[model samples]
Target chain A: MSDALHDPGTGTPGPPATPVLSATGLTVRFGGRPALADVSLDFPRGRIVALIGPSGSGKTTLLRALCRMNELIPAAVTTGSVRFEGAELYAPEVDPAEVRRRIGVVLRESALFPGSIFHNVAFGPRASGFAGDLHALAEEVLAAVGLWAEVGGDLDLPASALSAGQRRRLCIARTLAVRPRVLLLDEPASALDPVAAARIESLIHSLAGDVAVVVATSDLRLAARVSDVTAHLDRGELVECGPTGTVFTNPRSKRTEAYLTGRIP
Target chain B: MTPLATRDLLGTACRLGAALTLTAAIALLGVLLVQALGVVDVGFLAGAPSRFASRAGVGPAIAGTLWLAVLTAALSFPVGIGAAVYFEEYAPRNRLAGLAGSALANMAGVPPVVFGVAGLALFVRGMGLGPTILAAGLTLAMLALPTVLVTSRTALREVPRGVRDAASALGATRWQVIRRQVLPAAGPGIVTGLTLALTRTVGAAAPLLVLGAPAFVTHAPRTPGDILTALPTQAFTWSTRTEADFAALAAGTAVTLLVLLLTVNLGALVLRRRLR
Candidate 1:
């Protein structure tokens, strides 16, 4: 097996505290065709883990499985345990909505609602029944994502008025408003220019000190640059995972080497 | 034929078909206007049906039609929109839901007279409402329900999946996501569909005829329990008469009906814009 290079000890981060989120023996199938097979990963608090792979290599499926987001698809069947703070997320008693609120996701698309800038940012907290002033909360999250200054504090401005880069940042800010313990971003910066992408990456770097972040991306360079740990997958199987430096410079498996060197799609 | 030549032919055919439809509609309108030129006036609008053609007025018929339209809308819209929301936003993708969806689609294509027959059995005779405005209104609402449900589902489906996913990802419950995002994004489309469905119901005559709407009534309906008389029935009664003057009065009633439908459509247009 290509997993001969998979050293379980090196693959897991030695965080001072228990992981904020982790997936064990996770297998996801859509219409009985496996998308991810027996994959395992950990996301400890205040750390960034980047999941990288070629197109349709189950990078997205893995990210969705981590937070129980795959349940939304009618044909998708996920088997395994995803734990948040040592509690099983897939248990019958667990509310998927509650799990989602605690673990926010920013999709590949901006996916802004048809509303003002403030509404988009305040949506999470308001939907969760925030008792505090929503305006103050909107301003706080917008500033956190570096959008307040650019928007000139016009909270009432329609979300569509913003540029593409600004809209992406607004999506991130929306997720942050919920104060999630873990953030899953699916190619959040893939649609942006290099400069805008750098801005997003820096924002993500700034956020790593508080929120555990998992980014799924095709951009190997991005995965190398932002992630503390990197996990690579190929054909629904995890080829290798370890510290970013080791995975990049000295991949243990030929598949990992082939993918990193652009030898395989 | 070559692919490019065939494409050009198809485009020309489509344009010709569209022009033909538009021309036919305008020509019909022109004919109605010419026939009703001298027959229609405030006096004609305010008078009741009579043995003397000049004395026949459509005031009571207009009122009945208005009442029927309002009742049909009140009965149909809430139920139809609610069913659509349940099917689109809440229902599981199971056999039952698939069966229900197909049932609604098939019902949308059912002849209006068929609904009238069912309505006669259910609301008219079975419910003991008699051939009153309430019975007619209930029948029309039934006729309109399937269209509204089908159109409403289409409108809800028009909303992008990304919007729902974005809201769901925020940890918003299904109800919250529907109320705050899905409904708002789909509001204009839903309103547009409702407007078209309502206009269709308002113009329907076969169902009313089958419901046994009175050919002539002495006064405008004062309540839902009052005897029913509508523009379509009045026009039908007049048009069926051998008198030339009654035929002219029928044309005038048709003109009035067209104007009323136009007004309703215009009002819905404004509502649609406001929703957007």
Candidate 2:
């Protein structure tokens, strides 16, 4: 498949190139029940791909599989090749920690640590032994996520003191502080109010030039608004993947059309 | 019966149990206080145990108790916490690990005197440490280890899996995730567990009695090498005497041990708050 999908910003096709990360024939099962089946996709750097499906359609599972995050579940069994920077992720010698560090994920709950804002934002860099000034890096990411102004530049304030939107932004800032090549977000705005969700959408859009972003979301509007390419999944199967406008306006598969038209989940 | 009526009955039963327990505790404390009034002075606290009740003090016993508490904490805390971490974090989900975990859970509930018997055989007869404070400390450490391990594991498990996942997603190694996230998140619970284990070991008389703690020592223990003597054993010895004065001294010794235990519990409470 070509890597060039219409750029969400300009609606112009980008140059085709080798993907920064690619998954081929990926299949994942939890205790003999398949969650994702033979899903193949490519994630090119500096582009955002949104995976849209109904609940239990395996969007979150696909995102976790990309970084081998599914391995954390004891019952999860995966078969397939996921290549990041041309190296097999499931190789016996490959360190999962390194893969995860290079390809970060933000879970739906935000999951900020019960500590100061600075502590939450700086956690990834500190864990990875980043040699740069942590304070400056934390400030930068917080500012990028638009949380620094809301927190009033008080990095030491307890993370729990922040509102729901601010906490989600802090989680994003934490992931960004690690400087990953690929960013996976699962329902980043699903749990927020409209205003907060809009803020998160803009913040995610602002990340397009810096990282290869994959978003797994149930919101079709969000996928169309922020993604260059959109992949539709249903019941552990990939139905269609193409430019966002094409996927929404002229879907090839009947399943995609039905779901898009609110005829079926 | 209706659900509301059942609930009311249960509440009344609980309230009655609490009242009975409170009344019993207060009665016991009142008796001890009345008896310990004149006998528990600074001179009585500092003086050595004597044949005469008026000249007796728990100085050596108090020193021995302190030493035992220190040694028990030093030996058990690290080993127990390490074993707990291994069981929770690193151990594979296999039959052997499951068996070992079950064994630890069972051991936590075993009587302290059982550990003392093992310690007597292992440290005293087998290792030739004798009935010294070292031997008693080692015995208490044995008594505390299982309790510490069980409680620490429980504390570690209480930390949300999300915390571990978040740390792991940041590229943290297993050890780094445990050290930075899991341990800090579980700190207060661990501290409370350690405090409970330490205090239980501190106040235990059965283990020391089983280890043959001497009733009378002329001087405070200069080192762990000295003969083992503690407030529990001292109080037990004094309480066994027919003299009324000796009974008063025993109550005073018990009162002193209670105060020391309260101090330890208060310190642990403050530490837990800070950690949280």
Best by lDDT: 2
TM-score of chain A of 1: 0.93
Q: B136, model 1: CA deviation in Å?
A: 0.7
- Residue-by-residue lDDT tens digits, candidate 2, B1-276: 999999999999999999999999999999999999989999888999999889999899889999999999999999999999999998988999999998988988999889889988998889998889999999999889999999999999999988898888888888998999999999999999999999998899988888888777878998999988999999999999999999999999999999999998999999998998
What TM-score fits each model? Answer: 0.93, 0.95
Best by TM-score: 2
lDDT tens readout by residue for model 2, A38-123: 99998887899999989999999999999888998878999999987667888877778888888899987557788998888788
lDDT of 1 at B23: 100
Give Cα-based local distance difference scores for all models. Answer: 0.88, 0.90
DockQ of each: 0.67, 0.63
Docking class of 2: medium
lDDT tens digits by residue: candidate 1, A218-257: 9999999999999998777888889899999999988899
